[model samples]
Target: MKFGDIIVAMSIIAIVIIIIIPVPKSALDILLSFNISLALLILLISMYIEDSLQISIFPSLLLITTLFRLSLNISTTRYILSEADAGKVIEAFGEFVIRGNAVVGFIIFLIIVIIQFIVITKGAERVAEVAARFTLDAMPGKQMAIDADLNSGLISEEEARQRRKEIQREADFYGAMDGASKFVKGDAIASIVITIINIAAGFTIGIIINNMSFLEALNKYVLLTVGDGLVSQIPALLISTATGIVVTRAASDTNMGNDVLKQLFAYHRVMFIIGSVLLVLGLLTPLPNIPYIILSSSFFLIGYQIHSRLKISTEEEKEIAEEAEVEEVKSPENVMSLLKVEDIELEFGYGIIPLADANQGGDLLDRIVMIRRQIALELGIIVPMVRLRDNIQLNPNEYVVKIKGIEISKGEVLFDHYLAMNPGTAEGDIEGVETTEPAFGLPAKWITEEEREKAEVLGYTVVDPPSVISTHLTEIIKRHAHELLNRQDVKKLIDNVKEEHPALVDEVVPNVLSIGEIQKVLANLLKENISIRDMVTILETLADNAPITRDPDILTEHVRQSMSRYITKKYTQGNKINVITLDGELEQLIMESINQTETGTHLTLDPNTIQRILNSLSMNVEKFTSIGEQPIVLTAPIVRIYFKRITEHAIKDLIVLSYNELEPSVEIQSLGMVTLK
Candidate 1:
């Protein structure tokens, strides 16, 4: 039976004493409590003995308690039942067991108190340990997910690596904090308070049912129970319940959706409702037998309905949130807009930035914005973007600045100007060459045999489509001028080659000589009838042999140039490059290389290997009779012009190149000397 039922039953027993034995309320209250206590004690003892002795004592215990109660006359039992004292006993007993849950509540309180006392007295170090344990339990696969993202192109390889690291790091950090913080500021506090209150309430409730049976002191605000040294103070119970519920509601809200808090909040809700109704109904109800059973069933149904209602309300809230999110996506501007401002620190010029403009008043975020922009203008940055919070951010590895000062966030392209010019300039920037494509408006043209011949005859650096002296010299300068123009490096390099191939040196020098020697050498030494076109080209070939670029950059000699040359020859299929469909002279050259390949060619004609694949529509040819003209680029959809670099010593390496690269690659492949590192 519930505490309320027990209280009501006890009241009926009180009236039984009043009629059959004729005693005062206080004496009757003691007699009834003693009877119930003895009954409970006997029930527990019986269960224990029967389990050990192999005999059932349940019936005997029940009969003994029943016979004692049977001694009361029916008229007296009905009188006490009318007084609501029976309700109080039944209600109190049920409350003490169910709502009060004295056993569980006691243990929970002890644990919380002990933990809190330890935490307060010493420290809370194990909190992080506890949190880490939970985080470990929640960890997903360490690297495979990120690798899949990278391999499938969901992210770049670098980004996938970053993402994997980020997830694992975040989970670990969050787990540690979660486990530790939950108990410190969450359920542990509530458990200790609830336990003390409920235990005291139960005692007061037991005594109150005893007093309320007297009928005289039945006032709402008065003490309802009077035992040996205890009394159920109705006013105190009400005050405690009200305070506890409000605090509980707030605490529960705090813990909601929080992994740690959710567990704690549940325990609080379960205990609170039972404890409250038990104490109040026990000594108050005036109903007899029918009311007790009906109220018990009603409480059970209501509790069920309350649980359902909370769940439905939570679901509705989630639906409303989802709807709001859908509305936000329809507006592109809203989608692109940055989240609200957090914190801003402005910088200006090369020194400590001055706070020139002060915001006197405005929203906190607005003031921050005004001050930051004002400072940025002082520094001469044209368009200063507000830095947004970088949460769960992954670094773009493809475009990292040099290693000297690797600030991943600020860099876009891997080329840092400082590093390209003078590497190791500062921390975070690494040393690397930043090669800019000359393909913007026009690529500098190489002087062909006709243009260079014309330029040498005309005595000036000039070129047409077939090429010229000046343009060719500039091309040579670009490749070899990293060392000073007068460095003798190119000359010495050319001299060494000339010892074996004099004609090659003669073809290159007159068009491009060191600082002040170009005109004199050309005029004095018949730099002869050598076509300046072939001359510049030969010099370029020499410069190409120079060790300017080295790995992790490139080195034509780092690998056995002979072996590299061998592969180039071995990979070339037919001494003619083929353009799958285009069988022109250019196409023939490409086919020659493909046919010549003897080593295992890893390049497959798979769908994955093809990008922007199509066929050529028509042939395009541009004729330039003079210099200073644009070379036209013809596009034909049906024409298949793809890159082919037989380097990387691995045919599979072509996977990283772009569509434009294939054309140059095919050209390089024809040389039978190209090597990529």
Candidate 2:
């Protein structure tokens, strides 16, 4: 048998084997689909370049395999490309055709093309979802700083900031997961429906044109039959059914239902009608000499004039613009605005405000306290104002006072997450994170020597800027430490755990554990050693490690700490739980829960703890079990955020603290802080 025929037979045998046992169905499906896709990819490339016959041989093999595998729809394939498409070349040359004739060939072509589109959409969504998860956490953290200002005292701005974070923490947690959901529902579905409509439409139009009485000569030129393909290639005929299923299923989703309407209303339907008219005109004319270029140019000129002279936008543009604005509004602006004051100027979160406006010359400690309180009340979170022993340079314009995150009030500080150093930096000073443009919010910050090593390990930009941050990490931790120490929930979780499981009081709730210890406790919790005692320990640790509100270096350290702590677990062992971890708050919650558990004692958190955490988490779907095919990056911030969310997970639609919260070094601390940041 010829190699092409042998390949065809082998392809058929593989499909049959897959159907018979079905042991690794998903893997098999992916492989089968992927192979067909690759084959079609080669064919399209060759045809696009007008490759020689030598190169065309590969397209045949690929086309044959795909046809035999039935991985593409035959008709949708007909519509996507022009006559130069590789499949058409096979017709021109008459080398081989398995399911001979225009109709069947096009149908198979549609299946392959549709399958390719589905794969592309699927891959794009998966990558985007992952990128979105990261961007969501980073962006909202910036917004939490800004959002604190917009709250009209409905809650204490600090409360607003915290609440906003709570909301974002949930959103980011879930957005990560939701992106994947949309891929299945949105992108994949659009492909399927688009394919089906195009195919049905193509056949209907094709038949009608063939039947028109004036088209007898044209009908002879156009091939249309379901059986007896060119060259009598037999192998493809046997397995067309399976290929049809794969291509159809892969491309199909309900999301494309709307697109069908769009096609009908706009380009496709018009094109079909135009083509039919021209075909009829061509057949009816006795002179039989209608130039295609004249027709095309005339149509083009008419379209351009209509489109240009009107200078009017239809509902579509309005809808698209509205959608774009919505997206922009939804994404958080990442720049921090620096406020200029008589005594000192500093970069704050979102908008800028002068320290002078807030009262510049005050007792040092009192000024720090005022800044802290104002930051919390205005931004719904605290900002630390640490007097760095060694002043971090402000360079007449740059520095970010990022205390875990910054919370600014409504004052007009205009530094944004995105900024540009207007005049390109002096050559010597090009060492920071440079901005492409500042008008839209991208800013130029110089990469610091320390941040370079850090950026390498965790994908963070290590650029420096010319502004001072109002709050330092130490002050933030100190302030939050106090609030968290005194938070009603923390108090409640502690007291409840102590009361319900007395032995844990000492093992879990004694004083506070350092950030390092909290890290350990979190790692252990993920290992499944969750208990009330462990949770208390984590809370105390988080409270301790939450950067001191007045220490700059401490604040920077906190972000690093948090990122390092995000929970990332791979599910190689039988679809185990994959944590699309939340930012820091959620992870803090998990650590808090586990840290509360005691060694050598019975442990249980009140149902309220579970419920509150669950409620806080439900706003975003990324908080719980991971159900996707994605590679996870388990960084500290991500872990510190999502680890705590494990407790709030719903089991079969009912919420319960996951039992895994109480097992071994359930406290899995992957790293030891060799040196404190």
Candidate 3:
């Protein structure tokens, strides 16, 4: 081991040896002095530490110090009983400090024991017990808060883990302190008992074995006994007081000394009142006039100094604030700073801040991180970091989700309540503030926490405010995932694919198609709620088809057909897929309207025909919704994109897929045909 570790181990071993063997008077004196010095050092260190956990080793230290003192007491008692003299340290305390009076020395030692045991040690033990209990009880809530922060992206996983470790250390420290306080109490009792035994037994030894007179025995033995008690009790008192200080310490950046001065002297008015009271007391009392005058004068002067310092400090703060404002206005960088925008941003009103703030126990940042990860896994698109900001201009309960500086979705949430939604089969209506679910626009009600369990029992889905906001954010990002897929994102996907499928990437990217072309295809897939995670299939399909047609639209269609199994699995319900299709005549009309040119294919259908087709599709979509089925329109490969474009605004949740995109293993169950009257 290291030198310091060796020294500590040897010292502890020596303490055990001291208990078993008698030490010489000189060695006893040195150890006694060291004991007092060490106790004082511990007290000073405890006073300076800002947090109790800063000195987490204090419990073990308390145990060691208590043992050391007890060992010294035993060693000194041996010498006093055997040789009728403990040491010079004990003799000096007996003769000079207590003036050779055994009764007075005994009384002083008793008083120290009472104070240490009855007052300081008892209070500290109780406080440590309560602290440990409360810390343990609050651990689950604290851990949940940490998880929320981790999910919200406010802190990284490593930071959250460190915070959790600190919390555990805090609980362990208090629990250890609770047990260690018993050591101090037991040591105090041992000191008192040892003193009584030494006095009683030493007198017998002095008279019977040493053949000394009764008066001589009384003087020699009692002095030695009382002296030993005072020596041991002084150090024990100091340590008990130190233990109290350590356990009661609060966590702060400032030390005990700074906190005392700042908090105790914060107000000059209190000092001034105290000074005035002292002045009045001095005038009315019959005590020594000069001493009173000096004391009162000192208070007045100190109060005035504090008042003047406070005034100067206030003025300096105002000056600093004004200077900051002036600098902010004068600097051109402040204006330029506003020009830069985050890729994805979540702006919440003042009331919704608690949902995002880690300090307030909101886990919105952590939820956003999870949302990003979920999107990346499901859509194969690495979502950009979502920046959370507060906007006071909006209503308190409102929040807006933005993409590339544009507001894509906005919603409202109640922070102190839960949202209860009927799972479509509730027996009766619940009393609550009616509102729409922000995520899906389904009818919901804001209910108090007390009603959450009841709502759950009634088969109503209950969600907290943070979950609501997070869900809304998740849905909005999924809907706009295509918009977030830029050239840089495409490059990242390519690099990631390069690790496992380097040849496939090389064949398609820069060789068959550029990054821009790939971005368009990926964006097209994302817009249709299709996962681009199957990059091998996507790239291979593009590599085969790009030679014949350099069109992104046609290339995307080809990629979709290759990913038929994936698309089909999503729309499939158990063994069959229910779908709406166009009649043969309607399909022919759409095909006839397609005008191929050098630029691309264009639809030249009449407005009346488009209107009739939209109306028919809308009716079918509504019919699917009433039956609780998502409407998926099956069409010819040439018209799927065109049909989707025409009906996107009219039917937001409509899914248009080409016949080529259907898996052969899945059976298609056609619901109806969308034919014009």
Candidate 4:
């Protein structure tokens, strides 16, 4: 064991020993002096600490000190009752402090007991219990705040974890303190009982055993008993005061003395008013004038000094601020900061500021936090922090979403109106301002709150302004999510997988495929709107087939087949999938056109052939859209990748799935065929 650990163990052991074993007067005196010194040190430390956690060990310390004090009481009682002399410390207190009056000394000791037990210890105990209860109650809200910060990218995962740990520690500290305060209360009670017993028992023993008169017995024994009570209670009082200070201490950046002085004297006006009042009371009333006049002058002088100091300080601060502003403009770092590009930015106009400000009842930031979490669950990748900026350059209702400093999509919202779309089932049209739904480019109209219920009654889908913007932002992020996946993000994902499947990661990363290669595979999956949350299966598939082909495209295709169950469940409606299929000849022609090179595979189809294929695919896809079904293309495994490369730019929401990428149990109905004429 370390030296400190051994010392603490021995100290606790020695406290227990002191209760049983008799000691010399000199040794007892030293222990008494040490106890007093230790209590004073604890009190000073409590005053200096800015936070309760700074003295987290204090709860345990309180128990030990209480026990030590009780043990000393036992030793001193033995010396008083049997030998009639506890030590020089006890005797001196009896002789000098009591001044030969036992009754008065006992009364003073009773007052100290009442103050420590009823005032300080009782109040500290109540404060500790309430603190613990409040801390426990606020835990859920604090945890959610940390999660929101993590989701919004205001803090890193490590910072969130540290904050959560700190909150738990705080709760535990308060809970322990709640129990430890009882030790102080019990110590106070024990002191009174022990002092009474020492006096009564010592007086009887002196009269009967030593053959002394009643007055003589009372003089020696009662004096010693009162002295012992005073010595023990004095230290106990200090400890009890320290406990109150600790439980009541608020979070601060300075010690208690500084805080008290700064806050108490913060207002010079109050000081001056008090000084004037004291002057009037001294002059008009029959009160003594010298002390009152002297105090009044002191207060007035302090107020004047404080006012002058504040004025000078304010002027100096103004000058320093001016210098800092000039220095900031001259600094090269200022220019460099402007060059930094946000990965995802949502820049809106001033009219929409209320949507981002929480104080104004805006849930846009909260919605953004949910959007990030939604994206993570859907894509299995953490979306970068979305920076919300107010731009005066745009129109009051206009907002734009940017990816890597380039505008990807823009939308406009009516601050006080709702966008209502017909969904093809509405019975009639409503009179409103005509506008296009920004998310999907559908024709819609902006209506007021009065018209929202009427529009809904007419079978129209109505959405508020914030939802409109949030939906548009979500779509834009989903579309460009692949652009946000870099090697570093891929590494983070790989590390998370490694924690659970170390051998799988070790086999696949660098040994089978590089991080760049894995990033490409993940990006490809994200581009196709496939969820990579089943990372174990994806890695397992890669580990199986990576040796045969190092191409990310081919590896991605394998991972897709392995995730067939998920894809099947995601796209299937009523246990059936509606899809367009490629004609066998077209599939063959596309597969044959694929060119293999040192870099990777690519389709080398002539422009004419590519045009015919896209035209045929679009025509077949329209059939699914006519029935309000999502358009998906089913093709042979080899032709699926190359065919998607051809039609992705032409079809906005095209979903191409190979036969191998579907579950065997699901039924597929072919809506149309993409045959090149």
Q: lDDT (CA) for every model shown?
A: 0.33, 0.37, 0.86, 0.90
- The candidate maximizing lDDT is 4
Q: Write the per-residue lDDT of candidate 2 for residues 56-78, one digit (tens) a residue.
A: 23323434454433323232133
Please give each candidate's TM-score.
Answer: 0.20, 0.23, 0.68, 0.93
Misplaced by over 4 Å in model 3 are 137-165, 330-340, 343-399, 411-471, 480-677
lDDT per residue as tens, model 4, 1-677 = 65999899999999999999987889999999999999999999999998889999999999999999999999999989888989999888877766877677777768878998899989999999999999999999898778767655579878999999999999999999999999999999999889779878887898889998998988898788878887898899999999999989987999999999889888889889999999998999999999899999999998998899889999999999999999999999999989998899999999999988766888888898889889899889888888888999999989999999999989999998999999989998797899999988999999999999999999999999999999999999899889998888889999999998999999988898899988899899999999888889998999999999989999999999999989998899878988899999998898888899999999898999888988888787777778888888999998888888998888866899999999888899998999988
Better-scoring candidate (lDDT), 2 or 3: 3
TM-score of 2: 0.23
Clashing pairs in 4: none
Model 4 per-residue lDDT at 115: 91
Q: Please give the clash total of every predicted structure, in order.
A: 71, 146, 7, 0
Which parts of model 2 are misplaced by more than 4 Å?
1-289, 301-310, 314-471, 484-534, 537-677
Which candidate number would show the highest TM-score if scored against the true structure? Answer: 4
Candidate 3 lDDT over residue span 38-58, tens digit each: 999999999998788878899
How well does candidate 2 score on lDDT at residue 549? 40
lDDT of 3: 0.86
- RMSD of every candidate to native, in Å, equals 29.9, 24.5, 7.9, 2.6
**TM-score-sorted candidate list, best first:** 4, 3, 2, 1
